[model samples]
Target: MNLKKHILALTLLVSNFIFSQNTYVFLGSYNLDKSAESIQVYQLNTKNGNLNKITGVKNIINPSYLTVSPNGKYIYACTDTKTPNAGSVSSFEFNPENKTLTFLNKQTSGGENPVYVSVHKNGKWLVNANYTEGSVSVHPLLENGTIDSTAQNFQYTDGSVHKERQTRSHVHSAIFSPDFDYLFLPDLGADKIRCYQFDEKQKKPLTEAKVAFTKTNLEAGPRHFTFHPNQKFGYCIEEMAGSISVYKYKNGTLQKIQRINTHSDEIKEGFASSDIHISPDGKFLYASNRGKENNIAIFAIDKKGLLKNVGYQSTLGDHPRIFALDETGKFLIATNVNSGNVIVFQRNPKTGLLKKTGNEIQMENVSCVQIKKIKP
Candidate 1:
């Protein structure tokens, strides 16, 4: 009986090890030269939030933002290879068997300084937001995952309150609604969230919605927008004001439900909140504050889809521009662009708080972080 008990315990341990999922960490950076390593991949150990370097690639200049394909076989990045004023979007193929990324092809991003890129769920269309030129660029995806040339482009010339920053439209991020019926452009310079109807079947996929745009608070500088997993609520991070606007989402329309400050009231000026993301379970929300705070503000979601301030965690570095949570919501990785460090934190599922795991890596000018779980 003693031997049988020992064998049962050993079998259970082996089964658990075999069933664990493999998590991959992808980082995009703004490297000055094309020869230096700009995009790096790592394998993350979920048990302790440690990252093991898999492979690093170069030859692409300033691949600042990255997004994985829905099927997890490719990655799309916003970069500028030739001239800073004429940015481009590049594609790469990921091999899970050997854990490597190979450069595919790139195309012009329709405007200058493409800041964000996202792929459709069906993997047929790609969209990017141009920051400097204030435009939206659309591309068709070839069967082999390469991006075709730009098919359509929309330019925005309106401005808002700030004399310098908001003098013209600055399209910061392009995000698709949960149902994929519409695309939302958070224009930092325009102080508005522009809505467009998306039809994948058509060559020109974006059309002006009935409600062309929704006005945000003057000088809010909306940076990034994300929807809750429940798909009933959405959140936008206001960069200039350092606040979040919660909304009721339906049929590509956003009705503001509540607005909350991302930082402590006592700590007032120099607010530059960069990115916002919610837990996969829809119980918690995390937003990164860059300029003065350099910390992540944590919030808990109530039954009414409202947010309550829970706590804050220092990112262990400076200028936390972007951070991402793993699919399982167990680990949150924060990347600092100026300090050039990546820190991983283990999250508590019940309390929605993050604790540093003492696992970190250093890379210069790292602007984006993306986590994916590759299937076997």
Candidate 2:
């Protein structure tokens, strides 16, 4: 082949590859007695693994936990508040072309302090966790991504030994199984993960499972849980004990397998866990530890879904409340609430360990981090 022709062909191939890959990061701020709530958007350069703020700063109202749509065209956040009993979930239509978001609609969360929200796999129903009210609510979503007014709310009164944290059942998070057949609600105050048969078409739970399983340690305060991609195994992070418990789930039944501590043996007291997540490839798991131990615990996932501690890495900031992995699994962003910054880390694919990239973005009371791929 002629030299000129070969060069042209290579240029075309490179351009096509670059155009097919894109990513963006959206951060949720706590507001923390501030004037306005805000969410920051950033465009990620896939080639160099660098991130640049693209949407400037869009202000909302106390957006605590944010979730992106399955199609990546919309972003939803929980607008948590206590004044006048106004708590709602807001939706934003994302413009991937310009990396901007447009406010779509807002709907009441049916309870106070809606700290967490999740969309079912079918994208037909939205579930919320009301921390202060200790309840779970389900809202139906319209085709335009707006929520319906009618909601189904359920409150729990169970409690465990942890009088301070679990005095009243506090629903922390609600997640659906991969098949959208069952809904799992983690209650910090009850120290239990309740299972419900979810009916997406009806937008409500069919009936309570005969057996509702509780965690091994009462007052451990299970806050969040993440399931494996295959849907056979799951892991839950305990906020009070700073530990993780592995479980084998099948046919709506969860059997405890193992529990591992997030802190070192030498260190004692003043440690709490915030969030837990599994990699897209289902090969590794990561959990965040706050309060004195500002680090991420990395674990390797075996074929049997057992967890083996790989290692731990400092988040390079204080209070790593929440962290998320980029779609490509190349970068991880940890939101440091106390430090008022979001620290970026590069993930080693083979070892599943995080290395600080030395690129930190400053923000106030950052609580949650969510990422989506942008369109060209």
Candidate 3:
């Protein structure tokens, strides 16, 4: 109750309150086949791991994957088309004051069924991956946050071991290296991770990487990829074979070092594995499995860039397509596409384990989850 002590405490309380009022999260969904809102918003409680719905952005359909600009002033979504061989990417200007997204424009994805979209680090380019047509496209971004013309579209023409799913090329993910100097495109149908050197200065942003590409198991369908915090190693999750492939990365060359199973026990064929992400501290890695077992598998990362299976956690829903950690690494949210809900879990940073927070959002066909920190 001293005069100076009370003033200092009051200032700290006000600063903390201001920070709490500025955190938000965005959810993207596949609302075409279900009765749910599209592009919903939630406010994140900084003190506790809970989410509160703020508002929902309407008029967008099948925004399966979402990305935010480097400056956090724009939002990009893969707005998929129902018609076969048609896909597009949409950009919107975000108003942080009101947490409203204003649609800017859409650009043809240059391929079919775009499953992923990302904004380049330079803030001048956008990248998208079309799954059905097995092509990766790069588009230019206007200064006003709208999309310009597509700069390049490269198609992959090859098949792997699977007869049903690998009969043709299927590009699943396009991820940039930690340094932003290279692009890694994982092809499910081809069972390969194609590497391309990404130079923003060139007329064509992408060229064949120095090492070209690396092949996974014969029938392994690679779905997603992630890089370690040290930038010395890379990890990729195989969708068809339910495994993880770790590689040593240097100067655009990937040398496979180890391959491990995401699942503890081998199940029958036709199971699916999804997203992969490394913890911010690079101490742990996580992967999602759907099909038979709907769970998130956890792994511990050793000092030499290897994964040790820790355990698994049930997602509490079916078809866990995607999940994301908050910017602070305090919570993890998993989006179950088929079950139409998203669940939240509090993180134990020391142990790299997750505990269910018992918070869930009932979204229709939730496809993607993104965490956006609001400005003060």
Candidate 4:
């Protein structure tokens, strides 16, 4: 072949390879009936916002909440089931080229009904919240991204007055600070946000005077909390009372600055708030409201770390359990459980508003949405 022709062919090959790298949407499905678990995976076209199911129509038990590893090579799922004992967390190696998952191993979560799991920033530890046991547990991550045995477990023993929801302490979610120095456990039943001294080097939790606790409104039932990427502020979604509590963090202490109702005054019926998240740029906050409300409440974060109501958008489905922001901060996906679908929205970066993208991916009882980038 001529030199010019060979160069042109190589360029075309590179362009084709780049175009083939697919963005994926992974849904964690829940099975209230059997034990065999399944997670749905779909290939998403970034150019036109189209989703095609690649594989994983089968069932996987209890992968209700999921988090991708820092390297984006592994995906960890919190199976909210108690097989012989309590539920456990599992790891899966991801193949970005083919959009498939390979199971690695599982570790007992050291409590019951493990709802959420997150990896420490250093990638040295994995933390989980056990709802039924009302506890938080830490697991060491092996060099290959699998979890070691449970190293440390802390059980919360307090409860509040919401008879149906807060009868006992239920730790719904645990997350690390941006600096990875401390861990925050939001216990729904206890009406408290428990701060723990995290030892990254030792892969354990320490009981120390550094512990700080913040109180939520009685019967508020704090579910999931997310910190602003800048680490100056935090937000928590109260499940039972359907409210959002804003907090300011300084020197390892969290001070409650404001609490805002997630719903309008006209809708007085009780609803359950599910997940809370802040945008990557810290300009907006999003919370999911389930039950009859069935919408995502959006807020604008002011310069002073206070939230001003932006607006609310219906998830366009039932039981909006969890929603996630894409890596580019350009799109948001809401997992509607009862409706068995995930609705996509295009995010306006400048205004921090979400517009319906008219893209809905069908699945079964999807409780959580997770995204992983396809490597080149």
* Tens digits of lDDT, candidate 1, 158-227: 9998998899999999999998889999999999999999998898999999999999999899999999
List per-prediction Cα lDDT, in the order shown: 0.92, 0.81, 0.86, 0.82
Per-residue lDDT of candidate 3, residues 213-259 (tens digit): 88889989999999999999999999988899999989887889999
Candidate 3, lDDT over the whole model: 0.86
Over the stretch 1-376, how does candidate 2's per-residue lDDT look in tens digits?
6999999999997885664356888888777454444787877665555678766335567888899887777788898554348788988887867656788888888778888888877677888888877888888878898878746888888788875777788888988877778888888888888888886666355457766655558777888988998999989998888888999988777889889887766668776899999888899999999888899999999998988888999988889988998777878889998898888888888999998887888988888898777565
RMSD of each: 1.8, 2.3, 1.7, 3.4
Candidate 1's C-alpha runs over 4 A off are 1-15, 18-21, 81-83
In candidate 4, stretches whose alpha carbon ends up further than 4 angstroms from where it belongs are 1-22, 32-37, 57-59, 80-85, 203-209
- Minimum summed lDDT over a 10-residue window in model 3 is located at 31-40
How many clashes in candidate 1?
0
Rate residue 119 of model 4 by lDDT: 92
The alpha-carbon deviation from the true structure for residue 336 of candidate 3, after best TM-score superposition, in angstroms, is 0.6
How does candidate 1 score on lDDT? 0.92
Clashing pairs in 2: none
Best by lDDT: 1
